[model samples]
Target: MSSFVTPKKWLTVPLEDVILRIVGGGTPSKSKPEYYQGEIPWMSVKDMNKHVLQDTVDHISQAAVDNSSTNVIPAEIPIIATRMGLGKIVIADFDSAINQDLKALFLPTEVHRDYFVYWYRSVAQKIERMGTGTTVKGIRLEVLKGLEFALPPLAEQRVIADKLDTLLAQVENTKARLEHISQILKRFRQSVLAAAVSGRLTEGWRSGDNPERNFKNLGEAGVEVKTGPFGSALHKSDYVNGGIPVINPMHISEGTIKPSESMTISHQKYTSLEAWHLRKGDVVVGRRGEMGRASVVESDEPQLCGTGSMILRVGEDALPKYLEIILRSPTAVSYFNSDSVGSTMVNLNQKIIKNFEVYFPSLSEQTEIVRRIDQLFAHADRTEQQVNNALAHVNNLTQSILAKAFRGELTEQWRKDNPALISEENSAEALLERIKAERAAAKPVKKTRKKAPS
Candidate 1:
């Protein structure tokens, strides 16, 4: 009742009562191999991810620091990623240089560093409003300082920070536990697939009454497997609005075809590339760069796969789905790896695949094997999906917690206890005005770009 509070509850304080300093940073000459290889630690927005940054892939030296616009961040200063990471913030524990894509805001004595971090993130809506542009978005320095928000007292701020830290830590621990479960699920997937191809999966399906059908070496099974249509004619511009999907290596990950992100061609183009065009159940393998990774066509979409991928339609004796399981198995991977030898880049044509000796059950038994494999895989996939879903939910919750902590709402009880020790503030008007005056009075310091090394 003394100042700024509701019966339900809220607290308010001026913002300028908090800020100590604001500084921008830049990178040293990356062209100078010398600047890049030195002992000093350097960070980029990409490297900025949750909590402590124990190590960096790149470093620069004192000499590079002296030459570059990038400043050496003192300990405990908050480094905010303005782009790339786009909202990631971390406290610098050691001296470091950041690229031009970040901002360093040093907290003042009255404001808790953790509290300021929470507040900056809490006012995300306001930050987003100030952040404008088409190519990339960010708030202007002047505009950010001028930004206003209701704040709790110093004591309340610390409480909010403490609660946030505790809750966020719990979220992180939960995610790590989920990831561990996820890894176990992945291993289960590999084990199931491996067992399927090794003949162990169909052990009971083998009828003593049924005759075993032997698989012809892959080449004899069909013809020599050939590379995909090798023409630069398929330029990016040639891609049509819709037609046949053009599958790339990225589409085939972990030996599975992902049709979601697909490029298309005209039906006319599809006819011309008929030899390379994928069919209903063709087994495709990636060669050239990736070499022997494989997948099977599951989509009804008519399309030509890329040069990085090779397509082979096995004979009628070969079951498409059955072949897909084998090709994805570790045994098939090792077989491909062995045949496509000699160069760092493993290459295999129809000749090598045709020569691969594969074991097959009779048609009736083959169908049974596939059915059993699919049933077990369905169970494994369901478990993997659960872990993935849990990870996503945890990630969203963590971010939301961070968002709330920054806003004074996170510690409403603490604010009530502290009760407007200071008052007459609804927004950060004082902070805004102070920043403007400081910028106006400050003299510009020139920093020159360093020459590249020869």
Candidate 2:
């Protein structure tokens, strides 16, 4: 239903005019278990995800088909959802029985199957908007039939469909490669973190005069661990808008503090709970929910830790950034998962955090480790951003190509080169007449009975 101008020599008509018949399907009785346990492929809205369905999740018996309102659609026929999952169209690879929500469109032989499929896809969003319902939205048959369909010459339809197939397939392959690269970047970052914390990253730097690394409890390594204010100490009523911000577990992500402005306390309330205030160089960690969720307080801003978080103040011997890296490493995450308390929701206390053992290297070595990690992470962030942008463009390319095809822009040159094929007997108008004749010939004739009783 887009306002795209019709191409020259193309025929514009109602969608139903080109189709021979439209058949609605039904589900077999669930009471009969034997009806479901069979070899026949039975389709529903759930099975209509892919463009071509090779098989269905559910199957039904032929007896079920005989007894139910469902009909067996021939292979490669287009089926669309009228009820739930509106705007989806698919073709079955085999003869399949459909449930109540789907309708099979029987197109005339004059129409190219792939061409119709692509055309429907271009207008699918328009169809979805016409759907009406309170709970499950659905389109009426009349609404679907009333929509405009632009038809090109049969030969042109084939050319457009062939072009779309090749172009869309290439787009899909590019997306797959980008997605694979994204996963590789994730693994690369994890590997870097693992190496940094285990002394493997700085091993070569220490080869000349290797300094002894000692294993020590976090409390013994000049780190002060403290839990946030409990629910009794800071009530929900204390929170206010445009006040001192509160850093909860959700606010700590990607090794940085992102406090919520709305989840804050007034200056008066903050003064009373000043003991839980966060200072610059402090590490705020999530003590509940996900394990090893920690971030560094990069600024000396007015912020308070929430009930579900803990704070760690590193002494002169330790670097806060380096400690944050160790906490986010795979080894520390594994330890937190195994030792944390509670069943339904995992929780960590000051005692557990203080007793956690970690490698304690010299201050100079910690500085070097933090610098190297920052450089590597910056590179990963840049690469990830580029990949994300490319992915977004690739996603849009599909609809763009589809729009161009429907607008006749994709096959503009073909139209000029093959003018003879689109004229006279080969025109879309001529094709529609043939389709109409085919429909009239396929209709069954009803016999009249003589009145014998009279």
Candidate 3:
């Protein structure tokens, strides 16, 4: 125990001492066609994301629960995900039935539910790490029953919970505002790209400059478009340890080239596929998944276009960077989707890519547009970084608050203000005895089910 928590008033006890019951739930039989689509909310790991669950993705009939191992838990119970999600906890807003992955906790009247929920969150990460399994790691019933935690007097617990609620609400509000700003920034970036590709971005500069405003097809501009090697020309067996990197659609993200995690081809294979070699100015576009996803090859390293991709080598008439920006624009992306082939998975061929039209300007004007876009984008990046840093600090602050809270530091002043809660009537030990007595007295009640008329 930390120096902050004086053991005289704070009693360290096993979870089972304060917990009235721990109920393990089960799933209804999936083979029973009438088992589902009922009024009872059936919760799974996915529905446990929120702090409280008002409804679930699926529901089951009461007959289903009667036929299977599943049981319905009452409202206000805190359900902890024991298996798949591992430590995800949520309180039941309404009566709910859970799958095998969840275990609901029934806390004694002595322990405050909100207080325990916040405390559990602080140790959730540690509990998750202790789990062991080959596929889905989970905590056993013994582990949960044996877990120990320090409990403050009931009044102090309520005060601590109320304080945290006020503080965390402010933090959540700020985070939501930052998230909204991020969404606006995304729309701003798309607007900039849309204007740039439509010849409207440089309308002011065009008044004094003699720029080509005509829209022309890519093939008419002397650009060479080629697809990657297919059929027997390239095989998975040809890949070796390391010779040349293959640029795939996965390797291109956010308009930049990234290192490939896939296999590299041999030097002989590289020589055989010399036509697919990528150059510094070449713009590579995904020819299959996510049509119109393109990236500018800024690296001088030797690389070849991998399968499911296309390469565009621009001549003196056009700038490769400018062409890539056009390809990434909303208009070109829509065109690519419309012209794509294949039923299950739409793909682009060399012909469709070669005939795509784009609004062109003089080389100098293109350079200016690129320069302006870079300037605005850099500012946006800086703002985004600041937002991310602030959000990280907020996350760290939550953990810090929890640590201080569990250490009894949060209510130190409150403890001094309210001294009556330290007495035997309201003390944690007295409360434990009362809970035990209540359970002991309630056990002998016999339920008499009346028989039907004979």
Candidate 2's TM-score: 0.79
Query: Which runs in model 2 stand beyond 4 Å of their true positions?
Result: 23-49, 54-75, 82-86, 94-102, 128-138, 209-212, 226-251, 257-280, 288-292, 299-308, 339-355, 417-420, 441-454
Q: 49-137, model 1: which lDDT tens digit per residue?
A: 65567666679888888898988787778887665455567776787777787888766554567877766666554566557678788
Listed per candidate, the RMSD to the true structure in angstroms reads 7.1, 4.4, 3.9
Looking at candidate 2, the ten consecutive residues that score lowest on lDDT are 206-215
RMSD of 3: 3.9
Ranking by TM-score: 3, 1, 2
Top candidate, metric TM-score: 3
lDDT of each: 0.68, 0.90, 0.82
Off by over 4 Å in 3: 1-8, 235-243, 439-454
- Model 2, 1-454: lDDT tens digits are 5476768788788998988899989989999999998999999999988999999999999999999999999999999999988889999989999998999999999899999999998888888899999999999999999888888899999999999999999999999999999999888877888888788888888778875556788889878888999968999889899999988899988787788889999988888998999989889999999877899898877999899999998999999998898888887788888889999988998788788888778888889999999999899999999999999999999889998998889899999999999988999889989989998987778889878995
Q: Which lDDT value does model 2 have at 368? A: 93
Residue lDDT tens for model 3, 15-114 = 7777777777888888987889789999889998888877999999989888877779899988998887776789978999888888888887768899
TM-score of every candidate: 0.80, 0.79, 0.90
Residue-pair clashes per prediction, in order, are 6, 0, 0
What's the CA RMSD of model 1 in angstroms?
A: 7.1
